[model samples]
Every structure is written in structure tokens, then in C-alpha cells.
Target: MTRNATSFPFDIVLFDLDGTLVDSNRDLAPAVNHALSLEDRPPVPEAEVRNLIGGGAFAMLERALQATGGPVAQTRFAELGAELLAHYRAHIADNTVPFEGVTAALDRLAQLGCKLAVCTNKAEEPARDLLAKLDLAGRFDAIYGGDTLGPGNAKPDPAMLYAAIADCGGGRAAMVGDSTYDVRAARNANIPAITFRYGYHDVPVEELGGDAMIDHWNELLPTLEGVLTS
Candidate 1:
């Protein structure tokens, strides 16, 4: 793939997992449906499930419940959460695969001496499991999940992004993601953010307020450099 020869500008490139690095909607959507099925609720369509993602599995399931009908039964929320997680863990990568050009882009970034890491709302173990399955686990200097820093530490909170930067030895950092959660996290952390246009964004990618936007992984380096300089 073509690439920019400009010098790298950031110390770290932190990526959001689902919809950003990998397309796991096939598996994720099913997991949501499975949880709903257990509660005898009608299965939400996969297209709708994509929008419900990004806030983590609990949020996805909660949204599914709400989108299908009404408020989730508080008594079964935890049980359904556990069930969803278990189902997802068992079929983590059934249809999941890295987005086009992801590996090549990662290699290019690594060659530029940019530390790579992941900060995602997916729970840590499943995130690790999926990456390992795709052989991309070794690519990240650090991998942080929603549960990594305990409650409320996930993206949109900035804790995970901060942790990813710190884990990668700290320097200039920028975030890449496909949703508001990622951009909000980067903004809250006072860092630049780049949004991927092809991911599962619930709204217009422009509204996410990224420092820059990339429609393909091959554009990542140039976009990151542009974000840094601007």
C-alpha cells in the first residue's frame, strides 16, 4: 500500500477495538441476540446492534433491551450480562477479522517508531482473546479494556487512554476510533483524536469531532501526522 514518507509525529497511537481495528459485529450482534433470547425478548436486527456497540457489552445488551421494548429488568441485568459475555468469549472470532489494511498499517506505524496500544470499551479478556485469535495481540504495546480500571474508567472517561499512553512509556499520543466514546476520551484527555470512517459509527463521522478522519487503514499514518501538526 502507498504511505507518506513524512516523519512520524506522535509517541503513541492508541486504537479503539471494535469497529476500529477489527470488525466484530458478526459475533457481537449474535451475542446481543443471544442475551435477548434468554430473556424471551425478540432478537434485534444486526444492523441495529451495530449502533448499540461501543459502550461495552453491558451497554450493548442494555440498549438492545431498550430498543426491543422497555427498561431492562434490573434483577436479570447481571445474569444477562454474564450470559452475553460467556457467549461472546466462546465465539469471539467466529466471523471477526481485522479491517482491510490494518496489519499493513500497523507495520508501517511500528516502522515509524510509534508505540501502539489499544484502549477499548470491550472487557479486557475478550479483547485480548480476539486479538490473540487474529494474531494482532502482539502488535499492541498495551491493551486496556473497559473493566481494566474498574467502574467508570472506560473511554469517554479518559482513564483507559491515559493508561495506554502511560503503558507505552509516555510521549505525544493520539487516539483512533470509530465512535463518540473514543473521540470524547481523547478530548477529555486533552489529546488529538482521529476517527475511522468505515467503522460502526452511530452518527455522522464528522460529528464525532476527530482531529482528522480516515476512510481506510492505509490513510492512518498520514492522518495521524496531519492531526499532530494541526
Candidate 2:
């Protein structure tokens, strides 16, 4: 594709679902706690759950388990993970919401001819379900989740990112996310990444090594433009 300096800088903008696009921990924490409760483990505080995000349900649950006690057996852990997913699916959007200005930013991006897509470590079914409930699914050309390409193909691997771009019909692309996995995937895919400071990150957002970082959705477009064009 030919570059058009005056137009939007990227043909597609890939986003991470949990932290980057929506504040999901409000709902996620409870689901995690639900699983922990099944194991007679103490509940993880919602505030602290934010740090446990990024690696997906299993990882988050593992972190929660580790914090509360210790790791469970593989069979038991899988069962708890299943329980967590069931609870999460039932109440996925109870308290989850797009961060302020997300709608407006997405609108502006679409108007600028950017094809939006999601490349998340979340499983595809629930990710789609969550976005559909939020009325945000229609805005994206594609939504490639962790399980989309089968097991062992989630972010930080770059497989899903590449798949999302191809499914979006491939073009100049950039990633917008809030975790090391996201940034690492973007790097592996040779795309610039813009990190959101307000999203869940285990490390300091600055240490994630994104091409740029923004504290709000209002800063997204301009920051992305700068990253992609300069």
C-alpha cells in the first residue's frame, strides 16, 4: 500500500482487549475470586487483580492462587480455570466498560479510514461476547484472540498479531496495548506500539518499551500519528 502522509498513518490499528480497550478487572476480579472461593482460597482484592492481568485467565488465576496460597495441581487448576471462565462469561460486562473517551477515539479512527482490530491474549469467544455486549464489536474489522490460532500462540509470540493484521487484509499497522506481552508482540511483528498508562501493567508502563505511551484515550490518535509517521 502506498503511504499517504496527509491521511491516517496506519491502515490497521490492533488493540489489546482487557486493559487496552476496556477496564475489565472489575468483572474479572470477581470471577477469579469465584474460582478461588471454590478452592476455599481467600478472595483477591479487586485493586490488586489489575496487576495480575495481561497473561489471560489461566495466568491471572495462577497469580491469584499464588498470592492466596500456592499453585494447585494441574487437574485442579484447569478445573478452577473453567469455573472462572464460566463465572466471567455470565458477568463479563457487569462492571466492565471502555475507558473514558474510547468511543470518541474509535469513531475518529474509523472516520480517518483506519481498520480497527483486536489482538488479545483473551480467548476469542468471550472476547467477542464482551465486545458484542458493549456494542463495540462492530467497529473492528477483526478480533483475534489468544485461542484463535490454537494453544501456545498468544501475544508476545506475535502469531495472533500477525493473524489479526492479515485478517484485517494487511497494511501498515500499529499496536495499542498496556502490557509487556503487547509491546513484545508489536516488536516481534515489527510494528510500533502505543501503550496506555492507565491500563494494567505488571511493570512500570515506561519499562514496557512501547514506541509511545498515553494516559488517556484522548491522546491516542495524536500519539499514534506521531509514532507511525515520525
Candidate 3:
């Protein structure tokens, strides 16, 4: 792989938004609790909500409902899910913010001319809205949500990752995310992956199967550089 001012081994960097870039638990936890309250169920703890994320809104709600013994029917979940999405959108950035050093790290990557994109389990519109709210939307060349490629092409399937690479001009790429969905998708795509330690991982970060694990945004560039050689 050649390394130069305008050339690098990887031309694109795909990121998973929720856990990898932003900590959305503050807003997500309350929204799910509110949705649960609508069904007269007890509120699930914030920590539990954090664990349920990375799969998308519906999956999060499903797990929350299951935890509270609420109805899990197709219709019932849809009805409550609508409420949850609405609540989330209404207060998307109430407490959501990019993790420490995220903006600076993104700036560094952009300066290096690496095309950046987001592949998240969140819905397209909400993802855009949230990123815009946080002033991070303009930084990405593309953003694909769980529903962006239909219901079956989300993370852990590699469809979205493939789409992201193609959409970003189809070059050498790497994935940066926080959970199994991210790592598994990277594996399916046959791309190197780096897991961030501060994100919302259901299990252990070491077990997520990333090519590398980074504890802070400052380490991302070096990790990506290493991936290029190895």
C-alpha cells in the first residue's frame, strides 16, 4: 500500500453513529421509558436501554417491551414504536452529544482526504436529523441507516457496508464502530474494523472481533494507519 499526501491504503472510513460517535443513551433511555409508560409497564433502567441499542429503534423497543412483559405483537409494537420515534425526534439532542474528541478526530480524517460515512441502525431521517442537530451532518459523505436499504440490509448483514463503500466512491475502506453488529458487518464485507471502547457494547469490547480496539478518538488515525499495513 502506498502512503502519500493524497494517497493512503484506505480511502474511506465508515462509522457506526450511536455508540461509536455519539452517546445517545440519555435521550434514548427516557424515550423508551416513556413508551413503556404508555403501555402501563414499569420503566427499564437506562443501563438496560444502552445494552439494547445498536440494533435499531424497533429492536430496542422490542427488548424493552419484552423486559417489561408488555405486548410484543406486530401491531402493538408498531403503535408503541411510533410513539417512541416521535418522542425521540422531538428531543433528539436534548442530551445527546458527540463523544469527547469526536469532532477533532473527524476533522483530522477529513483533512487527510478520507471520505467519511455513517452506517448505523438508526432510521435515515432520524439519523440525519440528529447529525444535523449536533452539527456533524456535513462531515459525512454519506449516511445509511437500518431502513436506508430496506429492512433486511442493515448492519451484521454487510449490505449497508457495501452500499457505503460504493456510495463513497468504492475504494479501500475500514469500519469504526462499537458492537457485534459493526464488527460482524465488517467481517462479512471483508474489511478491517476498529471498535471504540467508549461506545455501547452489549458484551466486552475485546470480544467484538475488531481488527483493533481504540479507547479514544485520538488513537483512530494511528489504528487506521496500522490497518493499512497489516
Candidate 4:
């Protein structure tokens, strides 16, 4: 298919915020532990919390509740979310770090004139704060989180992905994320999705059926190379 006049031959890139860009659980892990501790529920492992992150704060909490074999009470979940949010809000940047080579990849995309933005399942305030804290806030033309877009929607729905593409101002764009949610979101939007090997999918990478997969952030440049060159 011919590229659209305004469509990117490789112009716009929409990135997932969690496992794709930064490991956010330094805030997430301790916050969950604190809340569970308050209820006498055993603390969730940091690794599990890390795996649980891409879906959003409440989703992670729900997973934790299941892990603990609880009644899945909303009141308890709300209590936990409040505590976790309080702590996480205070230390948003403490343990956050960009994946190796992320800056270099983004810099290359920038130099190539690829418009960039972040579309994340994380809520708006935290997604924006994390971007600013990581110093990656300026790279994207737009940012969208679950709360920022309005109620009752998120990834796998394509609304957030389309919003980012529109904000970047007319270009073919792809979704980069760690889970099936990303793939489904991209398909729903009629855009392509790329899965990262390093992120938090509960299943193995090959099962994802994305346009491409990468184990390292730097591989992106050459992956794009293969596409634009071919």
C-alpha cells in the first residue's frame, strides 16, 4: 500500500510508557506492599508487581488481590489504591530508570524527524509526571493516559492510540508495548503494533503476532531500517 501523503513512511512513533520506556515499579512495588501490609495481606513480590504494571494501577491491585486469595472486595481495593497512590505520588521518580539505550533510540528517531508521543495505560497525572521525571517529557508531541482521555476506556480500544497519532499531526504510527493489549489496540485502530521481548507479557513473545519484536531498544533503528529500506 502507498503511504499516505501525511502518513509517516516512518514518521510518527507512539510508545507505551511502562515496560517500553521505563520500569515504574519502584513506586508501584512499595506502594502495594504498604497497602497490603495495612490489611495484613502478605506483600506482593516486586517481580510480580513489575509484571503487573503495564495494565494500570487498579488492574495491578486487582491482580494482587487475586494473588492473595481474598474476597476481591472493592472497599479493600479502594483502601489499597489510596495508600499506594499516596506513597507513589510522593516518590514517583525514586526508582525509575529508562531502559538501556532508550534515549539513544529516541534521539535517533528525533533526528530522523519522527514525531514522538507516549500512549500509556497509566493514569494521566503519573504518566505526565514520570515523563517529566525521566526527562523524556519533551520528546513527544502528546501524552495520553487512562484518566486523561475520560472515563470507561483504555488500550485495546484504540482511542488512546488514535489520540496520540492525531496529536503527532498526521502520520502512520505504531504502538509499542509489552502485552496483548498493545497488539489488540493497534489492530483495533488499523495500525501496526510491535512487541518488546523485555517487557511484562504473561506469555512468550512469539505468540504475540506483531509486525515486529525486539529484545533491545537500539534494535528499533535497524528494524525501521529494514522496513524503510525494503
Candidate 5:
């Protein structure tokens, strides 16, 4: 994509994977339930499973287990997490899809000369796989996942955002996500954050503390312009 004559305020725009770019609960909930079934736990309704997302696979599994019954032993938890990932990978895009207006919005950003990158808490391989399967991978300059920077470097930790900005040839940037991890990471990195109100946030969208909140993809560019310019 060619840059327009008028420069976009932010050089790079980083996005979160699960809830920000796509509504992945259809496949994610089932994967969580699949792991729960191993412990004979009842399935969490897909709607409820939406609330369990955002942190990462293991964190999602932990929330699912806690909601169904209680926590499991670490070893068992690891095993269940493996099961969840296995099931998810096999059916990754079975029902997963981007939110309304996502493609158009991305195209608009590209036209505006904004380099896009995904800064997600999902593992690097699956994050790439999901985007590639959806044909959205090529739009991004980079994809940084929870495992991308090694242990203890996921969002709410700023490292991934910093890395993504640098990898995309650093300049002023903003994070667009659906959860606290995204907002907090942007704050930690001293950048602006624009959050989606319809994402998988556990708390009220107002409580997310993003620089700006958007209810739909159509609002993204204007919101980003507002946030960056104001």
C-alpha cells in the first residue's frame, strides 16, 4: 500500500488479536470446553467463554476451570492447556472471523500510511496461523505474540508493544485492543490506546482506561485521529 500525501499521525498501529481484530469465541469457547471435558467439567456457554478471553490460552483455561469448578493442579493445568491448544489449532478458523468493518477499516489505515502490526498475547505460531488463515497476515508488518519475546513478556508488560513499534520502524504509535492488557501495555509504553467497546473485556469498557474507546470498526480511524492529534 502506498502512503497518502497527508501523513497519518501515528507511524504504526498495533492491534490485539482475539477480541480486537476478531470475534474468536466461537472456536475459543469450544476449545475451552474440550479441555474442561477432560476433567468431566460442564461446558461453559459460549457467551460466558467470551469473558474468559484476553489474557492468553493458559489464563483462559484457568478462568474456565475456575468458573466450572475450581483451580486444577499446575501439572494438570498444563495438560489441560495443551488439550485446549490442540483442539483450538485443529479448528482454529472453523468459525472464527473478523468483526464487522474490520477489512475496510484496515484498508483505510493502509491507505493512510499507517503500518499495522499485531501485538497479541496468543502464542506466536497460532497468532500467525489464525491471521494467515483469515488472509489478514499480509496486512501487518509484524506479529508479536505472548511467546514472541520469551517468558514473562506478554502484554500488560509493554515489551511486545515496544518491540512491535521498533520492528515496524519506530515512530509515534498507538495500541488498539479489547482488554486491560492492551490499554495497560500502551500506558506502560507511554503511548495512546484506543479500545473497542465490543471486545472481550472482563470489566466495563469505561473502566479499561484507554485513551479512546470505539464501538465499531468504522469509528477506528476517526478515533485514532482524535486521540493522536488531541
Candidate 6:
């Protein structure tokens, strides 16, 4: 087989799992709400959960508390976080679907010889399972889970981003994700990052400081084409 670097401007197109590829947050919101309810807290809205996402479980939980103006307690939060993860695991694949044009976009990238991978703050089991369910499993050469290696492998840190680069064979690579966490990870890893306009982020897309900002998944194709062919 030919090397991925030859034909694609980026050898690998690494994605952020939650908002970028799949709507896993629908399942996540309910689990979080259930956890909150268990703690006698008010139910959280999905919009709140959407905004709280992208930083993995710990970051998400901390942000969720801040969003609701609830004092964050680490010990209590850990227990509640476990409950949320349990609930989330039970319904992980339910209601999860690939974003519009994702398959087609990936198809074009593959046809153009771009290797694909996933770097998600999601847990490995569910992240890997969701991709398999969406038939996007084989599409990626690797999946970097938040808990896969250890505590700090999650997004906004760049560890997983660097890992993905290594997994894709260590040449030209690009990170494509929807959140500021994703963009930050890419920038920290010293890889070019591209942000999707429509994905969740605490900061504005432009403020995330990605190499490029794209509003649609289909744009990935032409953008990548320009990268390699330029």
C-alpha cells in the first residue's frame, strides 16, 4: 500500500468524537441529569450539557457545576461522575448518529488517501463502540480515549493529539474537531488544527486559534485537497 502522506495534504484526519462526528451528548445529557437528580440537584438542560461538553468527564463535570452555579466538590463530584458514566454506558449507542455528510466527507478523504483517526474525550469503550456502530470504526486508524492511557490523556492537553499523530505514522497531520478543547489540543501538540463552525465550544471558533475554520464537513475535502496539492 502507498503511504498516506503522498497523496493527502494531511496524512491523517483526526476527529473529535462527540459533537464533530456523533451526537453522543444526547445520551450524555440524560445520564448527567440523572446523576444530578440523584444528588437532589435540579435537572440540567441539554443545551447546558452541550456547552459543558468537549473537555472529558472531569472537566465537563466541573464546568457543569459552574454553569449551574453549584459549588464543585471533588469527592462528591467523583461519585456523581461515576453514576453518570454508568448511565451513559448503558445508552451509549442509542440515538447516536453521524453528523450530516460525515460519511461522504470521510469517503472523499479516503478516496484521496487521507488516513483517519479519532481523538475524543469520550471513554474508549463507548467511543470505540459508537464508531463501530456508525460503521466509522474501520475508517479510523486509531481511537484515543479519555481514559485509555490514564487520567490526563483527555483533550485540551494534547497528549492524545500527539498519540494520534504517532499512530498515523508520524508525518504531516491535522486535527479536526468542533470544540475549543480540540483546537487547543492541536495547537499544543504543534499540529495544525481545523475547527468546525457548528460544533460545541466555550469560546468562539475564531478565538480557538485553529489553522483554519470550516463550517461544514464537506469543506474538509476541498480544504484537504488544497493542503496536499498546494
- Lowest lDDT sum, 10 consecutive residues, model 5, at 1-10
User: In candidate 2, where is summed lDDT lowest over 10 consecutive residues?
Assistant: 1-10
- Clashes counted in candidate 2 amount to 0
Model 1, residue 108: distance off in Å is: 0.5
Clashes of 4: 1
Each prediction's TM-score against the native?
A: 0.93, 0.96, 0.93, 0.91, 0.96, 0.90
Report the lDDT tens digits of candidate 4 across residue range 1-230: 32343333576788888888887776788987887788788988888787666568778777777787664567867878888788888888999898899999998787777888888888988889989988999888899997777876688778988888877776667677888878888889988777789887745667877788989997887776575336
Highest lDDT among the candidates is held by which one? 5
TM-score, predicted candidate 3 vs. hidden true structure: 0.93
Residue 56 shift from truth in candidate 4, angstroms: 1.0
Q: Which pairs clash (backbone N, Cα, C closer than 3 Å) in model 3? A: none
CA RMSD, predictions in order: 3.5, 1.5, 2.0, 2.7, 2.0, 2.3
Model 4 gets an lDDT of: 0.79
Which whole-number lDDT from 0 to 100 does residue 185 have in model 5? Answer: 94
- Which of the predicted structures, 3 or 6, would earn the higher TM-score when compared with the native? 3
Report lDDT (CA) for all predictions. Answer: 0.87, 0.90, 0.88, 0.79, 0.91, 0.79
Clashes of each: 0, 0, 0, 1, 0, 1
Locate the minimum summed-lDDT window of 10 residues in model 4: 1-10
Residue 160 error, candidate 4, Å: 1.2
Q: Give the range where candidate 3 is weakest over 10 consecutive residues by summed lDDT.
A: 1-10
lDDT of 1 by residue, 1-230 (tens): 11223366777889999999999998999998999998899998887788888788888888888888876668799999999989999999999999999999998888888889999998898899999999999999999999999998988999888888888888888899999999899999999988988788857766887888888988888777675697
| True-structure lDDT of candidate 3 | 0.88
Candidate 6 lDDT over residue span 83-199, tens digit each? 888888888878778888999988887777777889988889878887887788998888988887798778888888788777877767788888878878887887777777877
User: Regarding lDDT, does 1 or 5 come out ahead?
Assistant: 5
Superposition TM-score, candidate 1 onto the true structure: 0.93
